[model samples]
Target: MIRRNVLLLGLGAVLATTFPALALDRALTPEETQLIQQIGAHNSAIRTMAGRFLQVDSQGGRTEGTFFLERPNKVRFRYNPPSREEIISVGRGFYVINRKDQTQYAYPQDRIPLRNFLGDKIDLLTANIVDVTSSDAYMAVTISDDTPIGVVQVGLIFDKQTLDLAQWTLTEPSGAELTFSLYDIQKDVQIPKSYFYIDPTYKAVQPK
Candidate 1:
């Protein structure tokens, strides 16, 4: 059920995306801001990333998928069997397809929250950040913003030493959290452009 949210957010930490109605607005500390800059630079350096993902919804339901990502707003998720869902962004908008029902959902690219992760220069300093906490192992950034649907909150965890995104938890408007864990990430691999193509015939379902 929350698989949809994962696509909206799980695009990976070449990967992650969020909203929260009770927004947190404040000036980031100098040190906090600098760290974000470093993380953003690290993320942007990764031009392409492909990996396997494990997503667990608030209800603890699990779904598996393969994540493909290219910089500046192109990503795809090929869900495993029994899931029958494929989510892709073609530098324009996000397309969610249901193989079993032959249904497709579309959302404007700009309307998707936490899009900083998709840009050529992942800029967290400009994000509506709520808080940031870091440890020797990783740095966690919590961001919230408004979207076409509702408020969403996204927590991104980056491995401190390597600066690679380890995982992320996305909290939807309903306060349901979906956690996506990415592994076996291959960076800058040759992924053909056809991987992001969406057929013209699929019907579009408007976001709720």
Candidate 2:
């Protein structure tokens, strides 16, 4: 769950609108809407990537890790050892595992927010593109959709210059804000499929 929780957060100071019941409480002009669609197209260009990430919580706690991502619903976030938490998406399931405890949690990929970006191809135009805002350094795209957890909103940030995903933030219905920032990113890298395989020995924790 740490992976899921961390995936919902953001970094440093930003010019942000107040969180609302609906992610898009305001309106997007014709130009702004088209720009967001264009950004979505740019995102889908990434076929594979590997990078390091810093997951910062609202409390200022930070965990660092290396991530391997292959398109079409496969990613592996291996946190530095002491953290003992890893998140992997294989096929249609999201698996969060604790190395030290040998405990694992699994959920249908659709149950989690932002799976659109995790797919083999990123497609924001097809989803509920609730809001799109940008700053000098980052373009923040807020995607809102109804999941089993009710309505969920995810803010995916891309570097304005490169149009690469920089970070993502989300405020859980419970008011937990989580953010993840990526660095040392390399694109079109080879990632082994074994990286996503769940250990059969790990104990599965059923969702409540």
Clashing residue pairs in all predictions, respectively, total 9, 7
Among these predicted structures, which one has the highest lDDT? Answer: 1
Q: All models: lDDT?
A: 0.76, 0.70
Model 1: per-residue Cα lDDT over 108-205, one tens digit each: 77867647689888988787777677777778888776676576677888887787888888776676677789999999999998889886777767
40 Cα displacement, candidate 1 (Å): 0.8
Q: What's the distance in Å from true for residue 165, model 2?
A: 1.0
Locate the minimum summed-lDDT window of 10 residues in model 1: 11-20
Assess candidate 1 and give its TM-score to the true structure: 0.87
TM-score, per-candidate, Cα-based: 0.87, 0.85
